[model samples]
Target chain A: MSGLAPVPDAEHESVPIGSNDDVVRARQLVRALAQQCKLSLVDQTKLVTAASELARNTLVYGGGGVMRVGLVHRDGRVGVTAVFEDSGPGIPDVDQALTDGWTSGGGLGLGLSGARRLVDDFTLQTEVGGGTQVAITKWAR
Target chain B: MLKIGDVLLVSIQVELEDQVVLELQDDLAARIVDSGASGVVIDITAVEIVDSFVGRMLATTAAISRMLDAQTVVVGMRPAVAITLVELGLSLGGVRTALTLEKGLEILARRDDSRPAQL
Candidate 1:
C-alpha cells in the first residue's frame, strides 16, 4: 500500500449475465480490469474466481442479471470491484445465503461464501420477490 | 488430448464454460476406454478458475475413470483455485491431485509398476 493519490480513477464496465456464456464473459471482463489494476497473480485469480461464482449465481439462481466490473484506487492501493444484480425472486435469508454449504441450486453451495473469502470486502442485499445485489472488492496488497 | 506411455493428458488453458466442462467429462470417459489408458493426467495449469460445477465434473470424471481401470490425477491447480474450492465446500473428494504434470505422470507410473504381473 502506498500513499493515497489525491485523485483516483475508477474505470468501469458492465455486462449482461443472461446465460452460461455470459458468466464466462463477466469473468473475462473482470480479469482484464484486475490486470489493469496491476494486482498480483494470486489476487487476479482470486478476483476472477470470485466473479465467476457470483456470475453463475446471478444467471442460474437469479434468473439472469448484470455484472459490473471496476478498477478502483482507494486506501492508498488499487483494487477491483464487482457488483452483481438480478431482478428475480430474491433470497429470503441473507445469512443463510452467505453460509457455507447452503445452496438452493444443485451446487456445492460455495458460491456466495467462497466469493466472500476470495475478496477483501463483501456486501449483500436482497428482498423477497424483488431482487438481489452483491458487491465484492479485492485490493492489491 | 494426448497420450504418452498409456497415460491420457489434458491441459485446460481457458476459462471453462459449464458446457465445456461437461463435454470434457464425456470425452475423457470415451478416450480412457478407447486408448486403454491406465492413467489420466488433467493439467489445469492454465485454468484460472474452477467453479462448483467444474469441480464436480472433475470429481465425477475421476470416479468414472477409476471404474474403467484408469487412475485420474488432476495436476497444476492454482493456489487461489484450491482456496476457493475449499471455501465453496467442494472437497473434490475421491479426486487425486498433483502439483505438476511430471509428478502426475510419476504417480500413475508408480501405480503401474506396483501392480502384480499376470501369470
Candidate 2:
C-alpha cells in the first residue's frame, strides 16, 4: 500500500473534528466516499465505523484535529483513505496505545486497535511532544 | 420515544452524535425513573454504524436501566453493523439485544414473567 496515491482527479474532502457534531460529519463524509468507491455494505460500515473511532480520538484525546479523506486507485482497484491529524499530547507508547482495552481516557480502549482491524491498511505516526497522525485505507474487493 | 404498557420505547432515527448519545442516556435514565417502567427498548434500525463510543453508550445505558430495575433490550441492529462491531472487538457483554422491537419486548416480557411475584 506504500507509495499508493489518490487518483489524480478523484474526490477529496476534509472535515474538522472540533466537536461532537464534527465527528458525526466526518463519519457521514467517509460513508459517502466509501459508497462512491463502491465498497460492499459490510465494507462501507467497517470503514465508517473506523472513521468514527478515529475522529472521536482526535476530539477527545487529541483535543481536536482534522480528518482528510480521498479516493485512491491502484492496480485497477479503488479504495478510500482517511488521515486523522491531531496536535495534542502525543502518545508516549505507540504499542500500548494500540493494545486492546488500554486507554488513557474514559473509553473502552478499543479506538486505536479496533480501527486498525477494520481497515485494509493502517499507519500510526506520533512523537512524545509532537502530535499523532493515523492513516487508514479500505479497498473494495 | 413512546410508552407502551410498562415498557418505554426509544427509536433512534438519526445519525447519533456523541452528545446526542450521551443525552439519550441521561434522558432514558430519567424517563425510566419517572415512569417506573419495567422494560426499555432501544431501536436502532436507522443507525448505519456502531463505533466503540456508541457501543459504550448502549452498554452504559443498559447498565443504568438495570440498576433502575428495568430490563433494557437493544433492537434492530443492521447486519453490517453487527459484523463491524464484532470485528471491532466490542461484544457488549453487559447489554442485551434482540433482532427486532417486538422480539425485544418479548424478551423483556418473558423476563418479567420469570421473575418471582412480589408481595
Per-model TM values vs. the true structure: 0.89, 0.95
**Model 1 steric clash pairs:** A110-B88
Model 2: residues with Cα > 4 Å off, grouped in runs: A1-11
- TM-score of the A chain in model 1: 0.90
Q: Per-residue lDDT for A116 in model 1? A: 87
Q: Give the DockQ-based CAPRI class for model 1.
A: medium
Of all true interface contacts, what fraction is found in model 1? 0.68
Residue pairs with backbone overlap in model 2: none
List runs of model 1 lying over 4 Å from the truth: A1-11, B87-93
* Each candidate's fnat: 0.68, 0.96
- What part of the reference interface contacts, as a 0 to 1 fraction, does candidate 2 reproduce? 0.96
lDDT per model vs. reference: 0.86, 0.91
Residues A5-95 of candidate 2: C-alpha lDDT, one tens digit per residue: 2322335677889999999999999998899889999999999999999999999999999988988887899899998989898899999
Model 1 iRMS: 1.7
lDDT of 2 by residue, B5-84 (tens): 99999999998988889999999999999999999999999999999988999999999999999999999999999999
For model 1, residues B3-106, the per-residue Cα lDDT tens digits are: 99899999898778998888989999999999999999999999887877788889999999999999999999988788767765777879999999999999
Give the CA lDDT, 0 to 100, for residue A18 in model 1: 96
Question: Which candidate should be chosen as best, given DockQ against the real structure?
Answer: 2
